[model samples]
Target: MTDKVSEAEFLQGLIPQLRSEGYEVYLHPTAPVVPPFLADLRPDAIAIGKGKKLVIELVTSESTQQKKTRALANLIKEHPDWELRVLVVTSASRGNELQVQSREQIQNFLDEIKLLQDSNHVSAAFILGWATFEAIARRLMTATFEKPQTPGRIVQQLAQEGYVTPSEGDFLRILAAKRNALIHGNLHDLPQKGEVEFFREISERLAAESAAA
Candidate 1:
């Protein structure tokens, strides 16, 4: 298997991806102001589009959690828009323990964002890790397919029309779980042969669903 990409490069590439996907993104590298002072906090990167804004803070060091907390504090102070989103980019070596810890931290951050939204300062909030890009992409694609008027929904409807086996649906769910594991940086124990077979099966099922539709 290939070595994981560095977090810095991943964030760099991810910024444009977000832009292309119609999200406004910003990078905040330093805290904007001291608690007792009033000043405009400069973020590392900021993109504004799609009627919303996203603030990104990239950390490559072992102290990623600390850095994220600090950046989030500054973002709350500087941005008045209630619909702010945050992205945390770090290496997989940080391990699952750290990942769980980060999720807790992100939950708190989401709470703050929701407060802003409740006050009509923003619309929504999101927290994403750079390592989870592929998984996120899959989810976005699936959402698109599931939309009422999309071809994906049509394919699913056709599958139901043909009374496809419930096991087929179970297999798709399993594939999604495996993809989720890989995206969350928890695939170190994944069996290579099983993954290959699962992918092949999913591909064939998807094709059949499309044909039936």
Candidate 2:
């Protein structure tokens, strides 16, 4: 309802809500991301469903000219399967220099994740584990980058900034998708307990060091 958030944050928030409605979201799709029908065009984000595809465009004050925007809008209007949703953003994120959680608070959440895991609520544990990752990763990301990023981007940025290794980043990216499914109740099987523990450990360490920095 608020356009005060940056386009990145706005897009990030839509992803989960869209997934909950059975949509498959693709961010900044390129040739390989979309089928040949949309190969020549790029949307800020794409949400595909059984018989429809939503083409999302974020318009800032200094965004692409109105002519281009109109063209894209008109092009989509001709297609029955596509619909355009434009987001008019008033401002962009400039990043933050602060962490979102206290060390004690993060530790408490970590413990809760573990408790759920040990109690055979592994699905809940894994879901909570990723939420923990987001809290810490957001802190690191706001401090390091100029814009707010999604969980997928946060993991990549953490690796790029040397906060986590390349392998850790790769694994986290895969988990991020599963996390989406878990959050939306589409996941059938819980991830391995060891995998959840690894994610928890990484987040725990990141929160400590990020706060220290």
Candidate 3:
């Protein structure tokens, strides 16, 4: 991003790149159609592709910590298909705070996921299990961009290239759709025991491969 460009210009600049990557990028208009809960907190743009809805927010380092930003993250947290991509044009804040987990730490997380399933915490297991699957996809994926790609995009690319089997990819997408419902303030709907266990199996396999690599 050129330092001379304004936020709008900066965002407009990304449209071609985003579109080329298969995202149907929609720049801000008078009214962007977001969920009712997030109607007031409309993002700078919304990118839809690969079965995902990305809430793209352009923020400076200082504004990243503001109340609205925090609210945006919290509100978007529950939805599996939605992600908040914070594009910080400035480098003033502490750089990427993503933590690195050791092999043992990764194993612990895998164990916790299975434990959740064994304890009959299906909701917790399903959510964490999906997150773990997404996390593994992020680490194992070879694709790169100026910004981090959302998990849906990552999985889609992998599935396209045969890194993930069609059946596996389809199953995950079904679970993801079910998960979207579970998060929108709906707790009554939950995945079955077999589904949660399947997540555990996939997560463990991916974790092992990642560790080996």
Candidate 4:
């Protein structure tokens, strides 16, 4: 029986894949620096591959130490390795600080919408698409600008900064209204197809700008 059997089990399951990729895997290699977690719960293991050192943390579904996990990840990135990486394996929701949806994620969502649209689920797709777009917008605003308490305020602030065209800004305001209505149990106020498309276009632009920054 190992001291941390679950973590060992996780490494056992994953190491074969790392070896398949030609990495020299190690179990619990000692580090020059340790992340500040609870004194007892440090990194579970380490993997060296492709000229980088990966600090591995095996977390369960009930784990709640996300801020520390991220802090440790950032700390790992700041150090020297062939290159540095942190592998956090978990099956639970992390904090909002770690929830920036990537461009590929958004593209996958759009693809799903296309599939749903073909199945005559247009309204459902549109609603979900707007929610996703708004989430991106809110994340962008909070990261690059002041965080607003509400979606409408975030859109308005973006417009005020000349980040959005007047037409796009107006459309976003409409979507915010629709979101409010939807939350209040009114489906009739959902955005139209063209409006949702405009949100998509604006969201894509914002995402590109964020990446460039």
| lDDT of the candidates, in the order given | 0.40, 0.66, 0.63, 0.55
Per-prediction count of colliding residue pairs?
A: 18, 0, 0, 0
Order by TM-score, highest first: 2, 3, 4, 1
lDDT ranking from best candidate downward: 2, 3, 4, 1
Among all windows of ten consecutive residues in candidate 2, which has the lowest summed lDDT?
90-99
> Stretches of candidate 4 above 4 Å error?
1-98, 144-149
The reply for model 3, stretches above 4 Å from the true place, is 1-100, 142-151
lDDT of 2 by residue, 1-213 (tens): 233446678789889888987899988887665555554667778899888777776654334334444555556545767766555444444333233655566666676566555544455567656656666776666555433445787787788889998889888988888876665557475488888888888887898886886
Q: What is the C-alpha RMSD, rounded to one decimal, of candidate 3? A: 11.9
C-alpha RMSD of each candidate structure in angstroms: 15.3, 15.0, 11.9, 16.8
Every model's TM-score: 0.33, 0.50, 0.50, 0.47
The TM-score of predicted model 4 comes to 0.47
Question: Which of the two, 2 or 4, has more TM-score?
Answer: 2
Q: lDDT tens string, model 3, 42-118?
A: 67788888987777766442232335545666676667677665554433233333333445655655665565455
Shift of residue 34 alpha carbon in model 2, Å: 47
lDDT of 4 by residue, 1-213 (tens): 332565567678777876776777766655443333323345656666676665565433233444444445445434556222223233223323335556566555555444434433445445555645654665566565322236677777778878788888887777788867764457576566666566666776776775565
* Candidate 3 worst ten-residue window by lDDT: 91-100
Kindly report which residue pairs in candidate 2 clash with one another: none
Which is better, 1 or 2, measured by lDDT? 2
